[model samples]
Target: MAGVRISRAAGALLGAAGMVVPLAVVTAAPAQAASCTTSTGPYQTRVERFLGRPVDGKQSAADCKATQKFQAQHGITPTIGYAGELTWRTMNTMLAQRAAGKTPNAAGKCPTNKGRIACVDLTRQLSWIQDGKKLTYGPVPVRTGRDGAETRTGLKKVYWRDIDHVSSLYNVSMPYSQFFDGGQAFHSVTKSMWNPPGSAGCVNMRVADAKAYWSLLRNGDDVFVYGRKPGT
Candidate 1:
């Protein structure tokens, strides 16, 4: 502590003649919020439908206000009301979660022959466990990988599981992990599952869902992943 000296410009200066000189403190200003935009984004119609608004592709003042509010509520930065990629992706995930409702595998993309299998539909951001033709658990919301780090498709078996695992690479808590494909697994996160940019390839789930997964699934269980995540 004695050897560490604060420069005059950085902190209060030391007095040469035993007179103390005080420096005025400076602090960083808070960032200004983004203004709402009236521009129609590429996913305008989709955003409108998700918001329960008129499903027109045009962006009106009302639509802009609604979107801006939604973005703010969801902690989306630059909440400018544009139906951009991030906003649309978040909305899409939420819609999928709502629509799942006990029929997640209605399309039958996830093979039912595996006896008990965890099905991950990347397109709708939904995950559920099925036993033959019976719904074992879930139809819950999930957030998977982003653009370049897409969650691998096809069938994989759960190779490992940890109740309180920490990611060695990122040094973050990966609670209730059920590893299936390589480094990818199902884990719980503190943040919203639908938050933008997505995960590093693992399937992120809500705490409740992750805990349920820990209880329902075991090592060697089948995990089937299909479809393409909306943004990815």
Candidate 2:
């Protein structure tokens, strides 16, 4: 009887050992591949909408590439090559405003003399050069100031033209600067002005647009800024 009891105890112990062995072996095995889900995040949906995609919340490879491209143009960092929260927020806001037709128009008459003038529509974030009633240049995109640092609206004259000017206050390179209202000027910027946190009262433009403005207008040219920048 004693021998039978000992045999039974030993069998039970062996069964427990068997279970532990497999568990340990499974734990020691190599990890599985990363299962990147197909389901899209909320930010990804916003990005897709901004990009004119179907917005099905599918995180395809192409979607990621497009997001990366936008981030690169706007000088957004990390360049993760993916549509994350920050990328989505910036792009969505800009596109929403544009879709709502909040930008300014170029139909109105130039406020200054008929010789040559630059008309800036703050609401539309557009600027153009006109020869009185005739439109010569553009409705080019521009970046203006934030809430407290609003770009002054009214008639202004380009007092200085600095092709390679550097801002003394911010120490930033302001290429093709056409200073009109005090320190406020039309200059080139690498950062994306479409999103929030705009310039410091100056009119920020693309490098090409700023160069074009520099060539079209001279010092003392009239710069009429009208309308109000949206969200400011």
Per-model TM-score, in order, reads 0.77, 0.62
**What is the number of residue pairs that collide in model 2?**
2
- Stretches off by above 4 angstroms in model 2 are 1-47, 56-113
Query: What is the TM-score (0 to 1) of candidate 2?
Result: 0.62
Residue-wise C-alpha lDDT for candidate 2, range 112-171, written one tens digit per residue: 454688987777667778776666776677878766777889887886666776543344
| Residue 205 lDDT in candidate 2 | 84
Best by TM-score: 1
In terms of lDDT, model 2 sits at 0.64
Report the alpha-carbon TM-score of model 1 versus the true structure.
0.77
Cα deviation at 31, candidate 2, in Å, is: 29
lDDT of 1 by residue, 1-232 (tens): 0002223432231122121111111122434667779799999999898888998799998999899888876666678899988888788678767887888888789998999999999999899999998998988888788788788899999866667665433445677877676667788876666666677678888889999999999988999999999877
As a whole number from 0 to 100, the lDDT of residue 127 in candidate 1 is 93
